[model samples]
Target: MWTINRFPGLWLLPALLPVILMTVYPIGHALWTSLHEVMILFPGEPFVGLRNYGRVVASNYFQDALRNSLVFTLFAAPSVVILGTLIALFLQRRFFGSHVVRSIVLLPWVLPGAISAVLWVWVFHPSFGILNGIMRDLGLIEDSILWLTNPRTALMAVTFAHVWTQIPFAVVLMMAALSTINSETLEAAAIDCRNPLKRFRYIIFPEIKAMIVVLLVYNALIAFTSYDLVYAMTGGGPGTATTLLSFQIWRESFSMYDFGAGSAVAFIVVVISAALIVAITRALPSDLFAGD
Candidate 1:
């Protein structure tokens, strides 16, 4: 018989090895690369000691990309979480064809990111797009809005698309959270508090508060690191309007052949993601993690 003390973590090596190789090794390599002058055209990878990081930070591109990323995360994360919660609540009601509606709602989540990007591109196309047509019919606008092309609206357009793709996941998680609410408590609240808003505020909100925090953090991270949608939709914009850190990494590494700068940007992204997640968790109520 295999004793626990005799072979500590031996059995776990098989599982842990792959994770170490995949995550640990890449991060280590990126960190190593970031400390050097790793231009692909250069003959040698001379040690630079944070020069790549300094250069990336000093660049206007990095500042613009950072601003855009923050804005995207701010808008997309809350929109996904709030819209998802509301939709999940509406779906909880027993109505005709509710099952079908639930399935349809998950369609966006199931679709590939590239495909979703393509679909949204057509939806937001400047000329002869569905959105423009609808707005025109409603007398909302005299001319089609330049969504992907114009710098002013490009970031918001991408954020809207990201929110759309993310909402199905948020809804699923919120639905599961909502399912855990005690029916008796809900019914009692409904009787005593006829106001729907009051019921949500006092009862429903408390029950799903933990899940809300989780969804917010998760969605924020997704928005912060999102690349495929931006790449496929706007290709980092008419200018640098929609350029995010992830895209910046790609631009430096592949487009500009500056591997050291790319790795530095990648490291910055990792640090930012970690810090944002920590800040969000710390700012929220401690009771979020309380055991029943």
Candidate 2:
């Protein structure tokens, strides 16, 4: 009889079982469905090999969704990082009202995503919402603009909302990372006559580099998987300008009743996000977690 030793290694089996059941099984199921004409919401469909993949690859809707996903990621992730880092850095120092400011910035991260989305929907309302009213009163706009209705500004609006909701998370995370820096090390750099900017450029940035990269990868995955925000905010309208891949997948699966194509889209998104995370992890040296 062979016995498995109980260490941290024994915990791996339970952890892996859930991963296999929830993640691996669904992934395998989606991959299989992508290769066939799956009637997800109905019965009796014929198995068609690779035709769905070919169709999805050539479709303009898929192209548009992919493009929008990339554009949103490009803008939203960095905005959150830079803004969040600034907020974190500012709050790291002791000052009057600093605690209050930090709490205010963390509001979005505490709220439910659905609630935040709905709140923004009202905020951007063309007629009575605060945004347009303020803009109009300040003479920033000639008239109230239908933020979700206009294709040109729809992406920007959604991106802004996403950045707003996401920044709080980045702020707290990077702040925690910033707290781990050695004060003595910073003082040593100061003793060498390094300016504040130079200290950050050398000592500070290097210490938090891993956290920044991880945050980027995490935010990219979140942005790519985003559907609730886009759905509640724009609903993939006023001409599909703000349609993301997740919502597009929902449309294909439910609205269009094309399960095969939708499953393929899901698989592709997961693959792309996974690849990005793996790449970032590889770029970080092994010593990132090593204790001095």
Candidate 3:
């Protein structure tokens, strides 16, 4: 029979085995494939030694996708965080029917991404869409605006859709963090600092600083890896105006059947994501994460 001290490593094998098989193996295979010339059209995956990476790096598609992803992250992450924080603060206040409002606020986030994307597709429709109709009624535009079709607005449209879903998630996290903040601290700050901004800056900000950092990193990652929304809405069309890195990888591997290039892009994405997460973690204030 196995004893506690006798075979500690063996006892850990069960949990470790699943992780190795599921995560470790897939990552290892992807890295190996990226280094080779993998083609479904041809026979064996021949070793190319970074040629796949070089090819993808040189491709115009990769360049466009990278730029689009960056733009999306830049706009969407901030919108999510800002809107979420505001919404959370509003919901945090004591008021009549606040519970109902809080429940309503979660509807967008609770909806499936694909479903939201589909709904936005209709919202962005050139002629019959409600947004265009509303704009026309308000005399904002003489004609309907092709939101997802136009190159200039396509990326922004996708970013808006992503932000819409992300805001709720941010709100939830913000509210949770706000709950952890001591009420007496806020009340004391309220007396000292009459200005709301001053109160937030001095008292509330420090308490929720760690959550904000985490949310930024989370939002950045989600925006960078956006696919379902783009796929459902834009299809990476309008001359690849909204083609993100994740969507490009999907197009390369499944649509184009270039596994080597796809894997190379995937690994690059993983590396960038890891680096961003690390940087965000490091950027957090020392006291933000310090345990008492």
Candidate 4:
């Protein structure tokens, strides 16, 4: 007699085995490594007991990298969400060549991050760059700006490039959410809500609110952990202007050959990212996860 109790629970082990090996083991290994003094050039891995963490916290580079990461997330995440929603709204309308336009919009997102960064590097070049040429034609400036080289503009340039790559993803998700909205409800609301802004506030927004929150959290996490763009474009340069924590980890581990410090930084990033995700999820509407 097949009953609920008779069901083979051990059958699920195969599915769970991969997750344990991939996620659980790596995190445990990293945590263990962070507690020891392990250097590539050194002969021994000694028990340091949080010394690496203390050094990482006290370092000026760590402070700069942390601040830069937060600043980049602040700028890049919201820009991706807002621009994505706006573009999604435009594409929602049926018009000639709309399909073509939608395909074109996804080109940036389809390209590899390193490739996108390289393209942006050329675009932001001080001389013979399209951006500068456009600005010059518009009479915006006579002198060429060092976009990636200048400390002030370097972070902004990287953020812009990140935003461009992320927006297409946001648009696709938003459009999916928007498609679920009832057209009759929108039409009914249009009677009293003649203004498009009012219609969105009253009807469209409430429908897509959950997706918006999802996009915010997803994009924020991506921006916080971003590495490829910074590595390819600026190499965290102009003196640490664009160095995020992810880049800091790479530099500490490979560049400086301090595996202990890099592991500590990596663990810090994991903790903070997990906390941020949890906090945002809790603070938003409780019904966000509710099923229709």
lDDT of 3 by residue, 103-139 (tens): 9999998899899999999999998888999999999
TM-scores, all models, native as reference: 0.94, 0.89, 0.91, 0.93
| Candidate 2 per-residue C-alpha lDDT over 54-132 given as tens digits, one digit per residue, 9 for 90 to 100 | 8987989889999999899888887888898888988998899998998999999988878898998898999988999
Per-residue alpha-carbon lDDT of model 4 for 1-292, expressed as tens digits? 4754587876787998999999999989899999999998998999999999999999999999999999999899889999999999999999999999999999998999999998999999999889999999999999999999999999999999999999999999999999999888866887877899988886898889889998999998999999999999999999999999999999999999999999999999999899879987888878765764
Residue pairs whose backbone atoms clash in candidate 2: none
Task: Name model 3 segments beyond 4 Å from true.
Answer: 1-18, 282-292
The residue ranges of model 4 lying beyond 4 angstroms of the native Cα positions read 1-12, 282-292
In model 1, residue pairs whose N, Cα or C atoms come closer than 3 Å (at least 3 residues apart or on different chains), thus clashing, are: none
Pick by TM-score: 2 or 4, better one: 4
Model 1, 1-292: lDDT tens digits are 4686798888899999999999999999999999999997888999999899999999999999999999999899889999999999999999999999999999999999899999999999878789999999999999889989999999988999999999999999999999999989988998999999988998899888889998999999999999999999999987999999999999999999999999999999999999999999899878866763
- In candidate 3, which residue pairs get closer than 3 Å at backbone N, Cα or C atoms, i.e. clash? none
lDDT of candidate 1 at residue 222, scale 0 to 100: 94
Q: What is each predicted model's overall lDDT from 0 to 1?
A: 0.93, 0.87, 0.90, 0.93
